[model samples]
Target: MKAADLFEFPASIPFADFFRADALPWQWIGQIKKALASGFETNVPGSIPPGVRISGEVYIHPSVELPAFCSIEGPAWIGEGAQIRPGAYIRGNVIIGAGSVVGNSCEYKNCLLLEDVQTPHFSYIGDSVLGNGSHLGAGVILSNLRLDQKPVKALVDGKSVDTGLRKFGALVGDQAEVGCNAVLNPGSILGKRSLVGPLTPFKGTLGPNKLLVSKPETSIQER
Candidate 1:
């Protein structure tokens, strides 16, 4: 699906030009690196925490709330008013949009987080795109790679479409909600405002405004 269908890239974020609205959602994953490479000044706040370790070409707006203990690697951007909670691990090619929460004990890499997105507890977000206002409940994992380590394929229109990347994660659409402890399999696509019930192991594409529940028999219904 098109990135525009899922996210409206915020104007507050300087890298918006790197991500085109008409491009495929997964294609934006690769643009993360290119966005960081385009060059922006590194502007981390002067008040440094002893437990916080930041290295490489990183930009943290002065308004960002830094935790006492976190590891932030290079080629990353943390937007204004973002909260970086304790024990968060932010690796390369990551973008945290304004007012987003990079939650405690969460690991993020190669991802784009739009405005106000929250991954507020133990979650692994890699090679993915989180749209504006989307929230991930505690312990959610966006599994990026297949066990066989082949290119990830997305289920679009009930057919498999090759993504051509070995490490591709979920594309969480705008305002989507993923419940606690849910595992989103590789190349999963959650449409705008969709919800996945807690502890569900979900794959394939979920249409907009749908709710996927894992009962004795898994079922999808309008939210």
Candidate 2:
């Protein structure tokens, strides 16, 4: 339940080697081993143009943007100007930062999406982290378990934080702004410049410049 009360540090975004809370009650396999030591990568696509089927220890970048029956699988990393628009479905230790924007039928696993984040259309981010320039509007769905699924804890600033994992999701911070169809449940923590409106259904923390507009009308102001 630590990690400095489930992440808040970002005064200037230099998370050194990325992360390292010394395993203070994290789960999802220590957040996928601190997102594989925070140097996560995976944006494949080196020929397979016939129909598309990238899977060779992915790490694609150079103006990334794949569509056609998308099926990326590997130590995933599609950063630099990311934009996997069509039938998007990324798997494996994901990252997808940079210009981030995974639209159409979006679906990610072991997520991170930092840089200019944006789950464009139908979102389904897993084991989350979506921070930098955040923006998940259309159908934003990020509930990583815990109806009785146990092991999902994070209620920082008021205590109760214990993300020993059972598939923890939602920790959205940075330039947060989730609206349309928003439903970040689990360990939801939209801080820095927060604001969740349309169809909201958030959970735990919503502090820094908060403005969650739904369940009980939150509006902690700051920005």
Q: Rate the local accuracy (lDDT) of all candidates.
A: 0.94, 0.70
- Which ten-residue region of model 2 has the weakest summed lDDT? 7-16
lDDT of 2 by residue, 1-223 (tens): 4444334433322332445544342332345535455563444546545555676467778677566767777767666777877777877777666787888887888877667788889889888877678888998899898889988888866988676777887877667888888798887777667788889787887776767686566555565
Query: Which one wins on TM-score?
Result: 1
At residue 73, candidate 1 shows an lDDT of 96
Model 1 Cα lDDT, one tens digit per residue, 35-65: 9999998987788899999999999998887
